[model samples]
Target: MYIPAAFRSDDPDLAWQLVEDIRFGCLISGGLGLMASHLPFMVERGDAVRLVGHVARANPQWKELEASPVLVNFLGPNTHISPSWYTTSPRAPTWNYVAVQVRGRVRVTEDRETLRRMVLDLSALMEPDGSPWEAAKLDIAYIDKLLPGIVGFAIEVDHVDVQLRLSQQNNADDQRKVRAALGAGSLRERQVAETMTRYLGRLPE
Candidate 1:
């Protein structure tokens, strides 16, 4: 998360949007010599913001939470920016991307109600339009049987680091060039280009 002044972002709304946009993140924890679990999370904002997710109880990472520290990192649209695309001569290649880190120690729980609500809430977040697996329609007996295998946790958001390196350091002409080049590239590149476009007029000249 070493972000330059040009790339650093502190907008809380943007950070939350990015986290929700890319719900999947790498939960990093230390003390067992560093462990990571890739999990889909639901962002909770109230008196305090927290990232909620779960993992199998057997996953050793869960057991280490109390003894270790934790943080979750989410990555958004990213693309490789070729040096050839830039008008600036003598420039090396670089990546244009968005990344966020939610830093806090996780409070792990195995309470049946909490776990149930977590599963339901996660389902709803992933499927906002509603689904056949909606919490109410789901079989309670089956859910109960399955709940024991997993543990839920909520990471209180103590700090957030948002990085938006969408070619902001370059001049306007070079930014346009990168955008146009990416616009014609793959879908992922197109997405990165779009994000860059959104920030164009808003960022300083």
Candidate 2:
């Protein structure tokens, strides 16, 4: 991702937070050609950052992983910033958003234990109030029947590129105006505005 200094963020914690905030991501890989899959991934951070997710057995994207590096894109709230909201005259419209790109080599797995854990962990992450669902709740026969239809993989994250374009290039006064304009828009726009507000507050003026 091409990021200007004002919009670039190298904070590892923030990058991981973005992944947690946006559970869904696009996994891009190329071998014979470019292939992408939208998936909900769980992040595991220890000695290294790893992303675990699965694709349908019918999806050909999994077969290409060994031949290509993977790029996972986690996108956060984004909204259009109208130039009309800027205090500066002759300003052009721009987008205010946050996104993180994780690049790494992928290792595919079909082991029963690994697959089972992957499913359970994914379920736990998506549920509220500390995840009530358990993999054991399902019949073993049913799980066995379903297991072969999917393939799981883990990407050992080697690089994380973060971009946070939240009106940082503008003055504080103009930033407030932009936030107000966005807040008055749709729910998603308001979300984007809130992220901008929080991020801007952390910066030194």
Judging by TM-score against the true structure, name the best candidate: 2
Q: Across residues 74-113, which tens digit of lDDT does each residue of candidate 2 receive?
A: 8989988888998889988889889899999999999987
What shift in Å separates residue 106 of candidate 2 from its native position after superposition? 0.4
* C-alpha local distance difference test of each model: 0.87, 0.88
Candidate 1 lDDT, 108-151, residue by residue in tens: 99999999999887876677574555666788898889899999
After superposition on all C-alphas, the RMSD of every candidate to the true structure, in Å, is 1.8, 1.8
Worst 10 residues of 2 by lDDT: 196-205
Error of 2 at 39 (Å): 0.5
Backbone clashes for every candidate come to: 0, 0
Q: Model 2: what TM-score?
A: 0.93
Off by over 4 Å in 2: 130-136, 203-205
